[model samples]
Target: MRYLIMAEGEGDGELLLGRCAAVEGLFTDPPPPPREVLVLRGCAPGVRAEWLGAASVVGRTESGFEVWWTLVDAEVLSVAPHTGNPALVDVTIGAGVLPDDWHRHADGPFVRFELTTGRGAVRAVTRSATDGLVADRAAAEPLPLRLVGCEPAEPMRAALRKRRGRHPGYTELWSLDDTGRVMDRRAIGFDAEWTRPSVLGGALVDVLLSVDADGLPGLAARPAWRLWRAGPPQRAGSWRELDAAGRHAWLMLAMRRERPAGPDRSGGEYHLAGAGLRDEPGLHCAIGEALLGPGGYYGWGWDALFDSLCGGFGLVPPFTLVWHDFAATERELAGEHDPAAGPGYPEELARELEERGVTVLRA
Candidate 1:
């Protein structure tokens, strides 16, 4: 994979310098550092200078395989893969200069990089003129120029305002082959550890199915629980009035039914006791707090629910969950309440549970 960067203006070079330096730290394992740094000048007409270097470090990071380099004050920086042999040049490009799209809107100031792992391949090409970057892969793809983790550089952030909210709010774990092609990709959420191939593919599928036609996943609403007096408030016609244990039991049953019958089926039973009703009131509030934890996935909205059901919170399927006070639980869910309690909470829960074939039973 060849990465090219081109920068013009006063601070642009300095920015590239910092970014490249950071990348150099990516490869810091057994591989030894580059013994020689090469500098090339006047590579092309109107092109000022270029720098090339090599690092032998190779290892795994929380994200994926780490491989990168630094190019300060250079029009180009070229990188080669760490094959025991040093002759192979895997990446070659000018610092801050990205590749030109098939359509050439301009000829200057771009950033381009390619990453290939065992899971899949990602190629990004962004021209400063356009003000955004586009990264692509087979399974998980983001809206053009949408930054996932930290915010992007200044002008780019301003240009991406319209598309900024489109980020999936999760990181996609990827692995690359020796040749720099991405082989696998997995979508991971907060406080979650990366599992094997199954988790990767499963998470991606869950996201795709839950998202709207525009590919944006459902956004979370308000928190389902609010403190009132010493205990939680019970809205006149809401699921909050239901017995906590009973509601939890129903949710467990619903979860079980929602899954397909197969090897993955849990086939076990879970029980929720109603003893905590004084402290936790509504079904949504109790379940969100108990299962997802305080301020976790509670009342965030559909995406959070889907993510929770998909095991983002560490709960997997195939088991039956039972609760006492089934009738009281049912009444609360079917009751009327303000949207603040999450409008359509019951309907959405029922719809998803019914789809999965999860069954609820009262003891």
Candidate 2:
């Protein structure tokens, strides 16, 4: 959306600039100029005013100063500013009719205008929408990823720092203890940043063995970042040698699989082609029936399979998930069984089982 700003009387430019600054300050990351602005006229009629409120304001003019402000929907102005100047009245201007061009613009609803001048001269100017504003802004600026309250192991910390060095989008690390004690912090980047809870959790698990082997007892991490903890140190040479919990955790870190991205008609584990039938409907029906049968919980999805392995679905321990005709099953589940699609169910189920200290096998 676009908004027009015009000045008519003496000191008009200064007034317009002040108004623009006030409006721009509302956004945490103020957008660039020549961009759409939303103006609230008297009462902001017909507009949702939940984030707005009205108040009177006095500002310097060419003569001495002026006291004027259009009444705004109190509700709409309430939450408008992210910080500072709780008084929404400071950002408002005197009453004026919306320009005729406002209705003509294709993105008219989003565009607004504010004319700062002597109360008498108000004119409407029409112009085409400015192309590339949105794309230009996005390309010029990318959102950052902020890491706050991080207390990673030394190696883990180095790894995180390395990632930040490689990616300019990562904000400076905020080094804090697990108990929310701040050791060091740095400010960089705008306020808006993408946060992925899983990223920290995954990192913690990757360095779990190191933390334990160093004899660092009482080691704790932020609950939100501790997705999976490492099991006790083990010297199991094979899956059968480790205890149940150790085995589960090992498998979780080892096995992982990815599913195909697109649709395929090769059929899944319960397809009827293996039964010598070529009918699609018959195959689908058989597949559905098998999914509802014993040990069929795996058919539901990754979560269900994990639950079954943990005996959450009443399945006993010493569970062995044998993928009969492994290659064919892989082809059906992960289109053509592409290795790039990932380890598929094995990886997913193993992770869940490991989290819960449940042992299971995938063959």
Candidate 3:
């Protein structure tokens, strides 16, 4: 997939940075997530962790350590001593009690560790690793990125040569297909020095870079993660061309790119190929494709889905959702032993859609 450097911010869409290839970072296996130190202000006095890397203490490290947290049940604020203080880390945790709610702790927990795994947020990661990818390079000038053909506009290139460290930050890079059609857009700040090559024609080729975007790492579940690294599809129906794993990847990529809200199909009937509607993510991928075509963006979670149903995001309400090959599950979408919101997710999903004036046809 080819990529172009567009103007900073989403304001201007016409600007382009020409074409390039052999891009890294965005699609590549992300380096260890930048560690984020969880500062527990107004924490309790006796709060502590069982061990340094304990689940209740440090949480999930970005390096792939695991923890046990669920919606129904709980794992355990399960911390410390990474920096110092070998003192036994003690803490109390309950099922369904998450770290984000650390502030809610009645004892006022003092956080000493961080979830390096970024928890589940691909973008927002833990801070045990300390300095951030971009933050560390803050004082660094120019750019450490070396996109294959990162040729800026003539005017922009001239500016770079005249001023060594002039324009940086919020450098917008748009992933494009072979035909130069934009597939995805990412705005990442360059936190390094950009040494302009002496040659006029030569694009600034100094330093290597990494793209720290969402859904780029820790996707062992999505077998077809490479499908996403290839970038968005040229046309729609991207879901149709995907396998089960690819379907997951499609959702990952789709979640990053926000499709603008426009007029609905005007009370249209969209057919969903619901043959393998196994998980919630799978259902979202198929339904989004059915309504908004390939690489579509309807909503991932319940609250987001409600926003989509309200209107503006592609197909407004009053449309029919023909969910083919439908089958209801006995247990909730959550796994065994985990807390469940209901018996199954389908009924809840249907109830939400129908309430919003959507016609759900289960086939």
Model 3 stretches with alpha carbons more than 4 Å out: 9-19, 31-145, 154-169, 194-207, 210-248, 252-262, 328-340
lDDT per residue, candidate 2, 160-201, as tens digits? 344232222222322232343322222232232222333334
Q: Whole-model Cα lDDT per candidate?
A: 0.30, 0.27, 0.48
- Root-mean-square deviation per candidate: 26.5, 25.8, 10.0
Ranking by TM-score: 3, 1, 2
Deviation from native of the Cα of residue 360 in model 1, angstroms: 2.3
With candidate 3 superimposed using the best TM-score fit, by how many Å does residue 89's alpha carbon deviate from the native? 17
Q: Pick the candidate with the highest lDDT.
A: 3
For 147-204, candidate 1 gives per-residue lDDT tens digits of 1222234332232243322222333323232343332222322121111122223321
| lDDT of candidate 3 over 1-363, digit per residue (tens) | 266665554565455534455454454433332234333222223444422231333334334443332222222244333233343332323322222332232232222333221122111123323221112211112223455545456534554564343335356667654445555566654332454342324643432443344323334424434445455554655455555455666665676665665566558788887665555666777677788777777886566777877776767778888877665331323332112224346666788789889999987
The TM-score, computed over Cα atoms with residue i paired to residue i, of candidate 1 is 0.24
| TM-score of every model versus the real structure | 0.24, 0.19, 0.57
Clashes of each: 53, 19, 28
Worst 10-residue lDDT window, candidate 3: 131-140
Question: In terms of lDDT, which candidate is stronger, 2 or 3?
Answer: 3
